[model samples]
Target: MRNLQHYTDDAFEFHKEVLKSKNTTKKDPSYKERIENMDDAIEGQFSAYNDNFVRNTLENIDSYGHTDDEKNDLLKLYSYKNSVIKNLKVKITTTAANRIINTCPNCTISEINSFDHYLPKDEFPEFVVNPQNLFPSCTICNGYKNYIWIEGGKRVFLNLYLDSLPAEQYLFVNLAITGDVITTTFYLQNNGDINNDIFEIIETHYNKLHLLERFSANINEVITSLENTIISFVGKLPLDEIKDSIIEKSNRDRIAFGHNYWKSILEIELANCVEYMNRFVTID
Candidate 1:
Protein backbone atom coordinates (compact mmCIF):
# COMPACT_ATOMS: atom_id res chain seq x y z
CA MET A 1 0.00 0.00 0.00
CA ARG A 2 1.20 3.51 -0.78
CA ASN A 3 1.37 6.25 1.81
CA LEU A 4 -0.86 9.30 1.34
CA GLN A 5 -0.22 12.85 2.39
CA HIS A 6 -3.11 14.34 4.35
CA TYR A 7 -5.07 17.13 2.68
CA THR A 8 -3.95 20.62 3.64
CA ASP A 9 -7.35 22.18 4.36
CA ASP A 10 -7.79 23.55 7.86
CA ALA A 11 -10.39 21.42 9.65
CA PHE A 12 -11.77 24.32 11.72
CA GLU A 13 -12.21 26.54 8.70
CA PHE A 14 -13.82 23.75 6.74
CA HIS A 15 -16.28 23.05 9.52
CA LYS A 16 -17.05 26.76 9.88
CA GLU A 17 -17.83 26.93 6.16
CA VAL A 18 -20.09 23.91 6.52
CA LEU A 19 -21.93 25.58 9.37
CA LYS A 20 -22.36 28.73 7.35
CA SER A 21 -23.82 26.85 4.38
CA LYS A 22 -27.54 27.53 3.91
CA ASN A 23 -28.40 23.86 3.76
CA THR A 24 -26.68 23.16 7.09
CA THR A 25 -28.24 26.07 9.04
CA LYS A 26 -31.88 25.71 7.90
CA LYS A 27 -33.91 24.11 10.69
CA ASP A 28 -31.00 22.21 12.16
CA PRO A 29 -30.41 22.30 15.87
CA SER A 30 -27.54 19.79 15.72
CA TYR A 31 -25.83 21.88 13.09
CA LYS A 32 -26.24 24.97 15.26
CA GLU A 33 -24.77 23.16 18.27
CA ARG A 34 -21.92 21.81 16.16
CA ILE A 35 -21.20 25.28 14.88
CA GLU A 36 -21.20 26.66 18.41
CA ASN A 37 -18.67 24.14 19.71
CA MET A 38 -16.87 23.16 16.51
CA ASP A 39 -13.50 24.22 17.86
CA ASP A 40 -13.66 21.80 20.77
CA ALA A 41 -15.08 19.01 18.60
CA ILE A 42 -12.44 19.45 15.93
CA GLU A 43 -9.66 19.53 18.50
CA GLY A 44 -10.95 16.40 20.20
CA GLN A 45 -11.31 14.65 16.85
CA PHE A 46 -7.72 15.38 15.88
CA SER A 47 -6.43 14.27 19.28
CA ALA A 48 -8.41 11.04 19.15
CA TYR A 49 -7.23 10.31 15.63
CA ASN A 50 -3.57 10.96 16.43
CA ASP A 51 -3.72 8.79 19.52
CA ASN A 52 -5.68 6.02 17.77
CA PHE A 53 -8.29 6.50 20.51
CA VAL A 54 -11.38 6.45 18.32
CA ARG A 55 -13.48 4.47 20.79
CA ASN A 56 -13.08 7.20 23.41
CA THR A 57 -13.90 9.93 20.90
CA LEU A 58 -16.97 7.99 19.76
CA GLU A 59 -18.12 7.84 23.36
CA ASN A 60 -17.57 11.58 23.84
CA ILE A 61 -19.44 12.52 20.66
CA ASP A 62 -22.26 10.15 21.62
CA SER A 63 -23.13 12.71 24.31
CA TYR A 64 -23.38 15.62 21.84
CA GLY A 65 -27.20 15.45 21.55
CA HIS A 66 -27.05 14.48 17.89
CA THR A 67 -30.28 12.89 16.76
CA ASP A 68 -30.38 10.26 14.06
CA ASP A 69 -31.57 12.86 11.55
CA GLU A 70 -28.78 15.27 12.55
CA LYS A 71 -26.15 12.58 12.15
CA ASN A 72 -27.53 11.86 8.69
CA ASP A 73 -27.38 15.58 7.91
CA LEU A 74 -23.70 15.66 8.83
CA LEU A 75 -23.08 12.65 6.62
CA LYS A 76 -24.80 14.44 3.75
CA LEU A 77 -22.25 17.26 3.97
CA TYR A 78 -19.72 14.88 2.43
CA SER A 79 -22.12 14.02 -0.38
CA TYR A 80 -22.88 17.61 -1.40
CA LYS A 81 -21.23 18.02 -4.80
CA ASN A 82 -20.74 21.79 -4.53
CA SER A 83 -19.17 21.74 -1.09
CA VAL A 84 -15.50 22.44 -0.37
CA ILE A 85 -15.38 18.73 0.43
CA LYS A 86 -15.67 17.99 -3.27
CA ASN A 87 -12.60 20.12 -3.96
CA LEU A 88 -10.69 18.41 -1.20
CA LYS A 89 -11.63 15.03 -2.64
CA VAL A 90 -10.24 16.03 -6.01
CA LYS A 91 -7.05 17.28 -4.41
CA ILE A 92 -6.63 13.99 -2.54
CA THR A 93 -7.17 11.89 -5.66
CA THR A 94 -4.73 14.00 -7.62
CA THR A 95 -2.11 13.87 -4.89
CA ALA A 96 -2.36 10.09 -4.58
CA ALA A 97 -2.03 9.72 -8.34
CA ASN A 98 1.01 11.98 -8.42
CA ARG A 99 2.60 9.89 -5.73
CA ILE A 100 1.83 6.42 -7.08
CA ILE A 101 0.28 6.16 -10.54
CA ASN A 102 -3.39 6.68 -9.56
CA THR A 103 -3.53 3.26 -7.94
CA CYS A 104 -5.53 2.73 -4.76
CA PRO A 105 -3.26 2.81 -1.73
CA ASN A 106 -5.49 0.17 -0.20
CA CYS A 107 -5.39 -2.25 -3.15
CA THR A 108 -2.50 -0.90 -5.26
CA ILE A 109 -4.21 -2.05 -8.42
CA SER A 110 -7.47 -0.38 -9.33
CA GLU A 111 -7.56 3.33 -10.18
CA ILE A 112 -8.83 5.44 -7.29
CA ASN A 113 -12.45 6.30 -7.96
CA SER A 114 -13.88 7.32 -4.57
CA PHE A 115 -12.95 8.90 -1.28
CA ASP A 116 -13.33 6.54 1.66
CA HIS A 117 -13.92 7.89 5.12
CA TYR A 118 -11.05 6.23 6.93
CA LEU A 119 -13.09 6.68 10.06
CA PRO A 120 -16.67 6.03 9.05
CA LYS A 121 -18.58 9.34 9.16
CA ASP A 122 -21.59 7.55 10.62
CA GLU A 123 -19.57 6.70 13.72
CA PHE A 124 -17.55 9.92 13.68
CA PRO A 125 -19.85 12.56 12.28
CA GLU A 126 -17.71 15.32 13.72
CA PHE A 127 -14.97 14.33 11.27
CA VAL A 128 -17.20 14.23 8.23
CA VAL A 129 -15.28 17.01 6.54
CA ASN A 130 -11.93 16.33 8.13
CA PRO A 131 -9.36 16.12 5.35
CA GLN A 132 -7.09 13.86 7.34
CA ASN A 133 -9.78 11.22 7.65
CA LEU A 134 -10.62 11.03 3.95
CA PHE A 135 -8.74 8.59 1.73
CA PRO A 136 -8.83 8.27 -2.05
CA SER A 137 -9.64 4.65 -2.81
CA CYS A 138 -10.89 2.31 -5.49
CA THR A 139 -14.51 1.14 -5.40
CA ILE A 140 -13.49 -2.43 -4.63
CA CYS A 141 -11.25 -1.57 -1.68
CA ASN A 142 -13.63 1.06 -0.35
CA GLY A 143 -16.59 -1.32 -0.53
CA TYR A 144 -14.64 -4.13 1.11
CA LYS A 145 -13.44 -1.87 3.94
CA ASN A 146 -16.90 -0.55 4.85
CA TYR A 147 -17.07 0.63 8.48
CA ILE A 148 -14.38 -1.76 9.67
CA TRP A 149 -11.73 -0.57 12.11
CA ILE A 150 -10.89 -2.65 15.12
CA GLU A 151 -11.25 -6.42 14.81
CA GLY A 152 -10.98 -8.47 18.00
CA GLY A 153 -9.81 -5.35 19.86
CA LYS A 154 -6.85 -4.73 17.54
CA ARG A 155 -6.71 -2.17 14.77
CA VAL A 156 -7.23 -4.16 11.57
CA PHE A 157 -6.08 -1.54 9.06
CA LEU A 158 -3.43 1.10 8.69
CA ASN A 159 -4.21 4.76 8.21
CA LEU A 160 -2.33 5.71 5.04
CA TYR A 161 -2.15 9.33 6.16
CA LEU A 162 -0.88 8.62 9.67
CA ASP A 163 0.90 5.31 9.71
CA SER A 164 4.47 5.10 8.43
CA LEU A 165 4.60 2.31 5.86
CA PRO A 166 7.68 0.23 6.52
CA ALA A 167 10.31 0.97 3.85
CA GLU A 168 11.84 -2.47 4.16
CA GLN A 169 10.89 -5.09 1.61
CA TYR A 170 8.22 -7.14 3.35
CA LEU A 171 5.92 -8.09 0.50
CA PHE A 172 6.99 -10.96 -1.79
CA VAL A 173 5.67 -13.23 -4.52
CA ASN A 174 6.57 -16.84 -5.31
CA LEU A 175 6.27 -18.33 -8.79
CA ALA A 176 5.44 -22.00 -9.11
CA ILE A 177 5.10 -24.09 -12.26
CA THR A 178 2.82 -27.10 -12.34
CA GLY A 179 3.04 -28.97 -15.65
CA ASP A 180 3.18 -26.14 -18.22
CA VAL A 181 1.22 -23.59 -16.21
CA ILE A 182 2.85 -20.88 -14.14
CA THR A 183 1.20 -19.53 -11.00
CA THR A 184 2.09 -16.66 -8.71
CA THR A 185 1.32 -16.39 -5.01
CA PHE A 186 1.77 -13.22 -2.91
CA TYR A 187 3.16 -13.22 0.62
CA LEU A 188 4.52 -10.96 3.34
CA GLN A 189 7.85 -11.82 4.92
CA ASN A 190 8.83 -10.75 8.42
CA ASN A 191 11.50 -8.11 8.64
CA GLY A 192 13.48 -8.17 11.84
CA ASP A 193 13.72 -4.39 12.00
CA ILE A 194 9.97 -3.87 11.72
CA ASN A 195 8.24 -3.75 15.09
CA ASN A 196 5.64 -6.37 15.88
CA ASP A 197 2.85 -3.80 16.03
CA ILE A 198 3.62 -2.50 12.54
CA PHE A 199 4.03 -6.03 11.20
CA GLU A 200 0.71 -7.08 12.67
CA ILE A 201 -0.97 -4.01 11.22
CA ILE A 202 0.41 -4.74 7.72
CA GLU A 203 -0.51 -8.40 7.99
CA THR A 204 -4.01 -7.53 9.12
CA HIS A 205 -4.34 -4.95 6.37
CA TYR A 206 -3.40 -7.55 3.72
CA ASN A 207 -5.78 -10.16 5.11
CA LYS A 208 -8.66 -7.73 5.54
CA LEU A 209 -8.22 -6.45 1.99
CA HIS A 210 -7.91 -9.98 0.59
CA LEU A 211 -4.92 -8.68 -1.39
CA LEU A 212 -3.22 -12.06 -1.73
CA GLU A 213 -6.15 -13.71 -3.42
CA ARG A 214 -6.80 -10.68 -5.57
CA PHE A 215 -3.20 -10.37 -6.75
CA SER A 216 -2.89 -14.09 -7.45
CA ALA A 217 -6.05 -14.06 -9.52
CA ASN A 218 -4.87 -11.10 -11.59
CA ILE A 219 -1.21 -12.11 -12.07
CA ASN A 220 -1.96 -14.61 -14.80
CA GLU A 221 -2.85 -11.86 -17.20
CA VAL A 222 0.54 -10.28 -16.61
CA ILE A 223 2.31 -13.62 -17.05
CA THR A 224 0.46 -14.27 -20.28
CA SER A 225 1.35 -10.85 -21.60
CA LEU A 226 5.02 -11.42 -20.70
CA GLU A 227 5.00 -14.77 -22.47
CA ASN A 228 3.53 -13.17 -25.59
CA THR A 229 6.29 -10.54 -25.62
CA ILE A 230 8.96 -13.20 -25.21
CA ILE A 231 7.51 -15.23 -28.08
CA SER A 232 7.77 -12.22 -30.40
CA PHE A 233 11.55 -12.05 -29.71
CA VAL A 234 12.30 -15.82 -29.86
CA GLY A 235 13.92 -16.16 -33.27
CA LYS A 236 15.06 -12.54 -33.52
CA LEU A 237 17.52 -12.40 -30.59
CA PRO A 238 20.17 -14.67 -29.03
CA LEU A 239 19.14 -16.44 -25.82
CA ASP A 240 21.59 -14.51 -23.57
CA GLU A 241 20.55 -11.18 -25.14
CA ILE A 242 16.90 -11.99 -24.60
CA LYS A 243 17.55 -12.82 -20.95
CA ASP A 244 19.47 -9.56 -20.49
CA SER A 245 16.68 -7.55 -22.10
CA ILE A 246 14.07 -9.15 -19.80
CA ILE A 247 16.29 -8.51 -16.77
CA GLU A 248 16.64 -4.89 -17.85
CA LYS A 249 12.86 -4.53 -18.08
CA SER A 250 12.43 -6.10 -14.66
CA ASN A 251 14.94 -3.70 -13.12
CA ARG A 252 13.18 -0.79 -14.75
CA ASP A 253 9.84 -1.90 -13.34
CA ARG A 254 11.36 -2.36 -9.90
CA ILE A 255 12.75 1.17 -10.05
CA ALA A 256 9.59 2.77 -11.39
CA PHE A 257 7.40 1.00 -8.89
CA GLY A 258 8.94 -0.09 -5.62
CA HIS A 259 10.33 -3.58 -5.08
CA ASN A 260 7.17 -4.61 -3.25
CA TYR A 261 4.82 -3.68 -6.09
CA TRP A 262 3.19 -6.88 -7.35
CA LYS A 263 4.37 -6.38 -10.92
CA SER A 264 7.90 -5.53 -9.90
CA ILE A 265 8.16 -8.49 -7.55
CA LEU A 266 6.81 -10.81 -10.19
CA GLU A 267 9.20 -9.52 -12.82
CA ILE A 268 12.17 -9.80 -10.49
CA GLU A 269 11.22 -13.34 -9.58
CA LEU A 270 10.86 -14.32 -13.22
CA ALA A 271 14.18 -12.69 -14.13
CA ASN A 272 16.03 -14.85 -11.60
CA CYS A 273 14.47 -18.11 -12.72
CA VAL A 274 16.74 -19.54 -15.46
CA GLU A 275 14.13 -22.16 -16.28
CA TYR A 276 11.51 -19.50 -16.83
CA MET A 277 13.92 -17.48 -18.97
CA ASN A 278 14.86 -20.62 -20.98
CA ARG A 279 11.20 -21.19 -21.83
CA PHE A 280 11.44 -18.18 -24.15
CA VAL A 281 14.51 -19.68 -25.88
CA THR A 282 12.58 -22.86 -26.70
CA ILE A 283 9.74 -20.84 -28.24
CA ASP A 284 9.33 -21.24 -32.07
Candidate 2:
Protein backbone atom coordinates (compact mmCIF):
# COMPACT_ATOMS: atom_id res chain seq x y z
CA MET A 1 0.00 0.00 0.00
CA ARG A 2 2.77 2.46 0.97
CA ASN A 3 4.94 1.31 -1.94
CA LEU A 4 2.57 2.89 -4.43
CA GLN A 5 3.69 6.45 -3.64
CA HIS A 6 6.90 7.55 -5.31
CA TYR A 7 9.40 9.67 -3.33
CA THR A 8 9.61 13.26 -4.51
CA ASP A 9 13.16 14.60 -4.42
CA ASP A 10 14.11 17.21 -1.73
CA ALA A 11 11.19 16.61 0.59
CA PHE A 12 13.37 16.57 3.71
CA GLU A 13 13.76 20.32 4.21
CA PHE A 14 10.05 21.04 4.50
CA HIS A 15 9.69 18.46 7.28
CA LYS A 16 12.61 19.94 9.21
CA GLU A 17 10.73 23.21 9.48
CA VAL A 18 7.45 21.52 10.45
CA LEU A 19 9.09 19.45 13.16
CA LYS A 20 10.06 22.64 14.95
CA SER A 21 6.44 23.64 15.59
CA LYS A 22 4.60 20.29 16.07
CA ASN A 23 3.71 18.03 19.01
CA THR A 24 2.50 20.12 21.97
CA THR A 25 1.17 17.71 24.59
CA LYS A 26 2.04 17.68 28.26
CA LYS A 27 0.97 15.61 31.30
CA ASP A 28 -1.94 17.34 32.99
CA PRO A 29 -1.32 18.22 36.62
CA SER A 30 -4.59 16.59 37.54
CA TYR A 31 -3.63 13.34 35.82
CA LYS A 32 -0.33 13.31 37.65
CA GLU A 33 -1.96 13.87 41.08
CA ARG A 34 -4.46 11.07 40.42
CA ILE A 35 -1.71 8.64 39.46
CA GLU A 36 0.20 9.32 42.68
CA ASN A 37 -2.91 8.67 44.73
CA MET A 38 -3.52 5.39 42.87
CA ASP A 39 0.02 4.23 43.58
CA ASP A 40 -0.38 5.02 47.28
CA ALA A 41 -3.72 3.18 47.44
CA ILE A 42 -2.38 0.14 45.60
CA GLU A 43 0.73 -0.06 47.77
CA GLY A 44 -1.41 0.05 50.94
CA GLN A 45 -4.01 -2.45 49.64
CA PHE A 46 -1.46 -4.88 48.22
CA SER A 47 0.89 -4.72 51.22
CA ALA A 48 -0.30 -8.13 52.44
CA TYR A 49 0.11 -9.70 49.01
CA ASN A 50 3.51 -8.09 48.46
CA ASP A 51 5.44 -11.30 49.18
CA ASN A 52 2.92 -13.85 47.83
CA PHE A 53 2.11 -11.57 44.87
CA VAL A 54 -0.75 -13.01 42.84
CA ARG A 55 -0.43 -10.16 40.34
CA ASN A 56 1.33 -6.83 40.35
CA THR A 57 -0.99 -3.85 39.90
CA LEU A 58 1.73 -2.47 37.68
CA GLU A 59 1.01 -5.14 35.09
CA ASN A 60 -2.61 -4.20 34.60
CA ILE A 61 -2.16 -1.35 32.12
CA ASP A 62 -3.48 -3.19 29.08
CA SER A 63 -6.20 -4.85 31.11
CA TYR A 64 -7.26 -1.80 33.07
CA GLY A 65 -9.76 0.54 31.39
CA HIS A 66 -10.02 3.78 33.36
CA THR A 67 -11.84 5.67 36.08
CA ASP A 68 -11.63 9.04 37.91
CA ASP A 69 -9.10 9.00 40.79
CA GLU A 70 -8.29 5.34 40.14
CA LYS A 71 -4.63 6.01 40.80
CA ASN A 72 -3.23 2.46 40.96
CA ASP A 73 -4.71 1.35 37.65
CA LEU A 74 -3.92 4.70 36.05
CA LEU A 75 -0.32 4.37 37.14
CA LYS A 76 -0.04 1.01 35.46
CA LEU A 77 -1.80 2.26 32.36
CA TYR A 78 0.51 5.23 31.97
CA SER A 79 3.57 3.08 32.52
CA TYR A 80 2.44 0.47 30.03
CA LYS A 81 1.54 3.08 27.42
CA ASN A 82 4.96 4.68 27.74
CA SER A 83 6.78 1.36 27.56
CA VAL A 84 4.85 0.25 24.50
CA ILE A 85 5.63 3.52 22.75
CA LYS A 86 9.33 3.22 23.55
CA ASN A 87 9.44 -0.29 22.14
CA LEU A 88 7.57 1.03 19.14
CA LYS A 89 10.37 3.52 18.62
CA VAL A 90 12.85 0.67 18.43
CA LYS A 91 10.75 -1.05 15.80
CA ILE A 92 10.42 2.14 13.75
CA THR A 93 14.14 2.81 13.85
CA THR A 94 14.97 -0.71 12.74
CA THR A 95 12.57 -0.38 9.84
CA ALA A 96 14.06 2.97 8.78
CA ALA A 97 17.59 1.55 8.88
CA ASN A 98 16.59 -1.17 6.44
CA ARG A 99 14.77 1.13 4.01
CA ILE A 100 16.28 3.35 1.31
CA ILE A 101 14.72 6.58 0.12
CA ASN A 102 16.43 9.77 -0.99
CA THR A 103 13.41 12.10 -0.90
CA CYS A 104 10.29 12.86 1.08
CA PRO A 105 7.15 11.05 -0.01
CA ASN A 106 4.95 13.55 1.85
CA CYS A 107 5.66 17.04 0.46
CA THR A 108 6.76 17.35 -3.17
CA ILE A 109 10.02 19.16 -2.33
CA SER A 110 13.49 17.77 -2.86
CA GLU A 111 14.92 19.82 0.04
CA ILE A 112 12.75 17.88 2.51
CA ASN A 113 13.35 14.32 3.70
CA SER A 114 12.29 11.87 6.50
CA PHE A 115 9.51 9.39 7.15
CA ASP A 116 7.99 10.94 10.29
CA HIS A 117 6.33 8.78 12.90
CA TYR A 118 2.93 10.37 13.36
CA LEU A 119 3.04 10.41 17.16
CA PRO A 120 2.03 13.76 18.62
CA LYS A 121 4.30 16.02 20.65
CA ASP A 122 1.93 15.25 23.50
CA GLU A 123 2.35 11.50 23.09
CA PHE A 124 6.14 11.24 22.99
CA PRO A 125 7.69 14.26 24.62
CA GLU A 126 11.32 13.15 24.54
CA PHE A 127 11.40 11.61 21.08
CA VAL A 128 11.10 14.81 19.02
CA VAL A 129 13.92 14.41 16.52
CA ASN A 130 14.11 10.66 16.44
CA PRO A 131 15.32 10.10 12.87
CA GLN A 132 15.28 6.31 12.92
CA ASN A 133 11.79 6.44 14.38
CA LEU A 134 10.91 8.79 11.49
CA PHE A 135 10.10 8.16 7.81
CA PRO A 136 10.89 9.86 4.49
CA SER A 137 7.41 11.28 4.16
CA CYS A 138 6.34 14.79 3.32
CA THR A 139 4.31 17.06 5.62
CA ILE A 140 1.17 15.62 4.05
CA CYS A 141 1.19 12.07 5.48
CA ASN A 142 2.83 13.25 8.69
CA GLY A 143 0.37 16.06 9.33
CA TYR A 144 -2.47 13.79 8.38
CA LYS A 145 -2.02 11.17 11.11
CA ASN A 146 -0.60 13.08 14.06
CA TYR A 147 -1.51 11.76 17.53
CA ILE A 148 -4.63 10.00 16.37
CA TRP A 149 -5.53 6.58 17.67
CA ILE A 150 -5.85 4.52 14.53
CA GLU A 151 -7.89 1.38 14.11
CA GLY A 152 -7.12 -1.78 16.03
CA GLY A 153 -5.48 -1.61 19.48
CA LYS A 154 -2.39 -0.06 17.86
CA ARG A 155 -2.06 3.66 17.21
CA VAL A 156 -3.33 5.11 13.92
CA PHE A 157 -0.31 6.80 12.32
CA LEU A 158 2.31 4.62 10.65
CA ASN A 159 5.60 4.39 12.54
CA LEU A 160 7.62 3.73 9.40
CA TYR A 161 6.37 5.55 6.33
CA LEU A 162 5.54 3.07 3.56
CA ASP A 163 8.29 4.48 1.31
CA SER A 164 10.75 4.12 4.19
CA LEU A 165 10.23 0.37 4.16
CA PRO A 166 12.60 -2.08 2.54
CA ALA A 167 11.54 -3.38 -0.87
CA GLU A 168 12.22 -6.90 0.41
CA GLN A 169 9.06 -6.45 2.45
CA TYR A 170 6.79 -5.88 -0.57
CA LEU A 171 8.96 -6.35 -3.65
CA PHE A 172 11.60 -8.64 -5.14
CA VAL A 173 13.74 -9.05 -8.20
CA ASN A 174 12.78 -11.65 -10.78
CA LEU A 175 16.16 -13.22 -11.48
CA ALA A 176 15.12 -13.95 -15.04
CA ILE A 177 13.80 -10.49 -15.85
CA THR A 178 15.66 -8.19 -13.42
CA GLY A 179 12.43 -6.22 -13.00
CA ASP A 180 10.89 -5.11 -9.73
CA VAL A 181 7.56 -6.63 -8.76
CA ILE A 182 5.41 -6.99 -5.68
CA THR A 183 5.58 -10.41 -4.14
CA THR A 184 2.66 -12.62 -5.05
CA THR A 185 -0.30 -12.27 -2.72
CA PHE A 186 0.07 -15.87 -1.72
CA TYR A 187 3.84 -15.59 -1.65
CA LEU A 188 4.19 -12.53 0.56
CA GLN A 189 6.23 -13.30 3.67
CA ASN A 190 8.69 -11.94 6.27
CA ASN A 191 12.18 -13.12 7.23
CA GLY A 192 14.07 -12.41 10.44
CA ASP A 193 14.59 -13.70 13.98
CA ILE A 194 10.95 -12.79 14.43
CA ASN A 195 10.05 -14.16 11.03
CA ASN A 196 6.95 -15.97 12.18
CA ASP A 197 5.72 -12.96 14.12
CA ILE A 198 6.52 -10.58 11.25
CA PHE A 199 4.93 -12.96 8.75
CA GLU A 200 1.78 -13.15 10.79
CA ILE A 201 1.76 -9.36 11.10
CA ILE A 202 2.22 -8.97 7.35
CA GLU A 203 -0.34 -11.65 6.55
CA THR A 204 -2.84 -10.01 8.86
CA HIS A 205 -2.05 -6.63 7.31
CA TYR A 206 -2.44 -8.04 3.81
CA ASN A 207 -5.94 -9.17 4.64
CA LYS A 208 -7.05 -6.45 7.06
CA LEU A 209 -5.42 -3.74 4.95
CA HIS A 210 -6.44 -5.54 1.71
CA LEU A 211 -2.95 -5.11 0.34
CA LEU A 212 -1.56 -7.70 -2.06
CA GLU A 213 -4.87 -8.95 -3.40
CA ARG A 214 -5.78 -5.37 -4.28
CA PHE A 215 -2.51 -4.21 -5.81
CA SER A 216 -2.31 -3.08 -9.42
CA ALA A 217 -1.19 -5.76 -11.87
CA ASN A 218 1.76 -3.66 -13.02
CA ILE A 219 3.38 -3.70 -9.57
CA ASN A 220 4.39 -7.32 -10.01
CA GLU A 221 5.06 -6.91 -13.71
CA VAL A 222 7.76 -4.28 -13.04
CA ILE A 223 10.28 -7.00 -12.27
CA THR A 224 8.86 -9.53 -14.70
CA SER A 225 9.15 -7.06 -17.57
CA LEU A 226 12.73 -5.93 -16.91
CA GLU A 227 14.48 -8.37 -19.21
CA ASN A 228 12.53 -7.16 -22.20
CA THR A 229 12.98 -3.53 -21.20
CA ILE A 230 16.73 -4.04 -20.86
CA ILE A 231 16.94 -5.67 -24.23
CA SER A 232 14.78 -2.97 -25.73
CA PHE A 233 16.98 -0.39 -24.11
CA VAL A 234 20.02 -1.95 -25.76
CA GLY A 235 18.55 -2.84 -29.18
CA LYS A 236 19.74 0.14 -31.16
CA LEU A 237 23.36 -0.03 -30.00
CA PRO A 238 26.07 -0.87 -32.57
CA LEU A 239 27.33 -4.45 -32.23
CA ASP A 240 30.85 -3.37 -31.21
CA GLU A 241 29.40 -0.61 -29.00
CA ILE A 242 26.81 -2.71 -27.20
CA LYS A 243 28.85 -3.34 -24.03
CA ASP A 244 28.74 0.26 -22.73
CA SER A 245 25.07 0.37 -23.59
CA ILE A 246 24.23 -2.61 -21.40
CA ILE A 247 26.11 -1.14 -18.43
CA GLU A 248 24.28 2.15 -18.79
CA LYS A 249 20.91 0.43 -19.06
CA SER A 250 21.50 -1.44 -15.81
CA ASN A 251 22.49 1.83 -14.12
CA ARG A 252 19.23 3.52 -15.07
CA ASP A 253 17.17 0.61 -13.80
CA ARG A 254 19.29 0.51 -10.69
CA ILE A 255 18.29 4.11 -9.89
CA ALA A 256 14.69 3.23 -10.62
CA PHE A 257 14.83 0.39 -8.09
CA GLY A 258 17.05 2.25 -5.62
CA HIS A 259 14.38 4.81 -4.67
CA ASN A 260 13.13 2.04 -2.42
CA TYR A 261 15.55 -0.30 -0.54
CA TRP A 262 17.44 -1.29 -3.64
CA LYS A 263 18.55 2.29 -4.31
CA SER A 264 21.95 1.64 -2.80
CA ILE A 265 22.08 -1.91 -4.09
CA LEU A 266 21.27 -0.64 -7.57
CA GLU A 267 24.06 1.93 -7.36
CA ILE A 268 26.47 -0.79 -6.43
CA GLU A 269 25.20 -3.03 -9.19
CA LEU A 270 25.68 -0.26 -11.72
CA ALA A 271 29.29 0.13 -10.62
CA ASN A 272 29.93 -3.61 -10.93
CA CYS A 273 28.35 -3.76 -14.37
CA VAL A 274 30.46 -0.90 -15.59
CA GLU A 275 33.60 -2.56 -14.29
CA TYR A 276 32.75 -5.81 -16.03
CA MET A 277 32.01 -4.00 -19.25
CA ASN A 278 35.34 -2.18 -19.19
CA ARG A 279 37.28 -5.40 -18.67
CA PHE A 280 35.76 -7.13 -21.69
CA VAL A 281 34.93 -4.30 -24.11
CA THR A 282 37.23 -1.73 -25.68
CA ILE A 283 36.00 1.34 -27.50
CA ASP A 284 37.51 1.97 -30.99
lDDT of 2: 0.36
lDDT of candidate 2 over 39-158, digit per residue (tens): 433333333222222232211222122343352323233221243333333333233446544344332223233335433324432223322224444444445445552345433332
lDDT, residue 194, candidate 2: 32
Question: Tens digits of per-residue lDDT for model 1 on 68-174?
Answer: 87677666667535466666666665642464346787887888777787677777776776666777778898888888877666667887766677768788888
Candidate 2 versus truth, CA RMSD in Å, comes to 13.5
What is each predicted model's overall lDDT from 0 to 1? 0.70, 0.36
Over 4 Å off, model 1: 16-65, 80-83, 95-100, 232-241, 244-248, 251-256
Decoy 2 TM-score against native: 0.31
Worst 10 residues of 2 by lDDT: 56-65
Shift in Å, residue 208, candidate 2: 8.4
TM values, all candidates: 0.78, 0.31
Candidate 1: worst-modelled 10 consecutive residues by lDDT: 54-63
